[model samples]
Target: MAQNKQKRGPMQFLQFGVIGFANAAIDIGTLNLLLLLFHTDAKGLLLLYNTIAYTLAVANSYYWNVIITFKRSAEGSNRQRILFIVQGLVSLGVNNLIFLGVNELLQLIGINNWLQYNVAKGMAMFLSFLASFFMVKYVVFRDYGKRYIDEKN
Candidate 1:
């Protein structure tokens, strides 16, 4: 990873925030649908459900961040796309860390597992969203080439 961050305006941050909110909704919606379809909340099932929902949310994030938030032209290359995935992976790690940690802590304190898991998820999502905005805005989506990319200056 390259770390050449370009200066961005407040409006761009707002656009990114809007997209994040949409994706967060998608994530929660997917999780709920999965739970309904399976009619169970086993540990393995919860993990699988969350994984699927997170992936969909990540895909949605990529699309909207590139199309609406970043507003890049058709200059994105394979290299940049790979970096985008890398950034997402890092974000996922950050999210999972907070989620598992919080959940475990709640369990230790005798919190109801169901409520504990949800609260953990919400907290993790908040922290990961913050991390992802910085990574996408400064690293993954930053212009890295010249004639190959007419990046927003």
Candidate 2:
């Protein structure tokens, strides 16, 4: 006898990708807008802008990923929410560090600030997506000990 396996379909991946794009847009758009409004050279201001934008994007991604992207695979209770939030914060820190580092490197290389900002944001988005996806798959929406028992029974 063959056992049943849950396979993720193309549509599922598409939906997740769409949600990821939306979250990335929100994050980058807000950061760019803030940069435009604030012409100050203060490092704190940049960090503040990134924090605000990242928080909003993370919240949006969490809800959408839970309700849409990984809905079929998600088996955890609200207990996973804390872990999700912690993982998000950690990802945010990593992303912000990379973004700032890239932006500074571009500036040092004489690239225009506007173009540098966009490039940095794009790079950060790609890196953060990889980090977040693995965290969500393994920690947030992991199987709740049911699969092994079911397989044996």
Name the candidate that leads on TM-score. Answer: 2
User: Which 10-residue span in candidate 1 carries the lowest summed lDDT?
Assistant: 1-10
- For candidate 1, the per-residue lDDT at 36 reads 68
> Cα RMSD to native, each candidate?
4.7, 2.7
Instruction: For model 2, state the Cα shift of residue 100 in Å.
Output: 1.0
**Per-residue lDDT for 38-106 in model 2, tens only?**
855566787788788888899999889888877866654667888889889888988889888897898
Which of the numbered candidates is closest to the native, going by highest lDDT? Answer: 2
Candidate 1 backbone collisions, by pair: none
Clashing pairs for model 2 are none
**In model 1, what lDDT does residue 124 have?**
76
**What value does the lDDT take at residue 36 in candidate 2?**
86
Q: Residue 8 CA error for candidate 1 (Å)?
A: 3.5
Candidate 1: deviation at residue 94, Å? 1.2
The alpha-carbon deviation from the true structure for residue 135 of candidate 1, after best TM-score superposition, in angstroms, is 1.0
* Native-referenced Cα lDDT, model 1: 0.75
